[model samples]
Target: MSWAEVGQRWKLRLVQVDWYLCLGLLFLLLVVISLSMGAWKLNLIVNDADALPIEAVAIRGERARTSDEEIQVALQDLMKRSFFSADVNQVQDALEALPWVYQASVRREWPAKLKVYLVEQQVVAHWNGDAWLNIHGQIFDAPKRSDIGALPLLAGPEGQSKVVLTTYRQVSELLKINGFKLDSLSLSPRHAWHGSLDNGIMLELGREDKMARIQRFINVYPTLVKQSKPVAKVDLRYDTGLAVGWENAQKESQ
Candidate 1:
């Protein structure tokens, strides 16, 4: 009717729109909470439900690291009781509690299943004794050597594994896979990388083009071995072929 009245009406319309949006957001939040919650039946559906049995979990479909007797004990505890239900977060926390699990994700897989996925800690390097720092930046005690192989052995001070692996990959490509094995890889503080062979010979691969340097070694190794002249240590830090140190000729006195 009047200018003031028109302005008042506009203000009222804006307030109504804001109220509806707020109501919509509140409804969405309620729906999410409803979908998320599980009726635990007073924690009765999941037997031994307060905290999961970490030792009993078989994440990534792997068998337990402990003995068969231990497994039987877990089964005994599981079966003697009735339903004790748990939520996905509880299961995830249980999985992460294990020493080897790096990180885990748990989700509801609908009416019947609660799915779990785990990324187990990897052996990055052997630290001092038998423990290894994994890829996820956590450390766990390593299994006996017999229990693991096909993994590169990283040697350096603590926390040097990531650096050594970077260099190892560069050098590893040049060598013929059938003829040689990378026994151990090491890195210096300045980031120099070197490796040893099973025969105890050392290889010096300077900071760059390590792949090319390794290839050069591959080309020269067979020829030296054939001549009955094995080099004590081979240095590829030079720009040209190689600087070789020889085993003292038994006839050095001559």
Candidate 2:
């Protein structure tokens, strides 16, 4: 071959070698980067294994019936989990499961701590014969206590707790204006309503226009209570008037 042809062939071989070298270096670079990334990911996972453990738990709330020991017992299951793995929602659910706890909030503090806040149920009245009613009319069962005897008794059909509670508040407030305090209120299965006052007087508020009936009784209460005999029962089922039953008066006539 001629010298010029030899030189051209050599140039072509050098160019091919240069291209192969570039490709090989690029492949090596990619391999190195992949290994480095894998090592970095592995290091991160290993470090997470040593993440701070939960060391302390703080519970905060107005606790009257539910004690701190009870709350701690509820959190026992959660204590098994790492600080990062523990779920706030699960904690809250556990706390709210307590009989007197109305609501619970849970949060994770930095490093190794958990914070919990709870709202206890506010007893508004005694429900049925076993449960107690909160201000929101939610019924919950709790251990019987003597201190709760003063709360007014409320009874109704299932699922009517809220309605009964609302009506009780309205009626009691109206009664308060007339210097009467409701001791107990009840709604019969047939929807009839009745109440007993603190003064031992029973009120019969029949269904339909019960509020108006009650208002009528309130308007005439002062005059009726001023009579010689103590009032025993006041039937407010009439349109314009109420039937007043005097204590011992029926026995005297007999």
For residues 7-62, what per-residue lDDT tens digits would candidate 2 score against the true structure?
A: 99999999999999999999999999999999987666534524546788888888
What is the TM-score of each predicted model, taking all chains together? 0.55, 0.77
Q: Which ranges of candidate 1 are over 4 A from the true structure? A: 1-60, 64-91, 107-129, 133-140, 143-145, 156-160, 247-254
CA-lDDT, candidates in order: 0.63, 0.88
Model 2 TM-score relative to the real fold: 0.77
TM-score, structure 1 vs. true: 0.55
Clashing pairs in 1: 44-83, 44-84, 45-83, 45-84, 45-85, 46-84, 46-85
lDDT of 1 at 218: 87
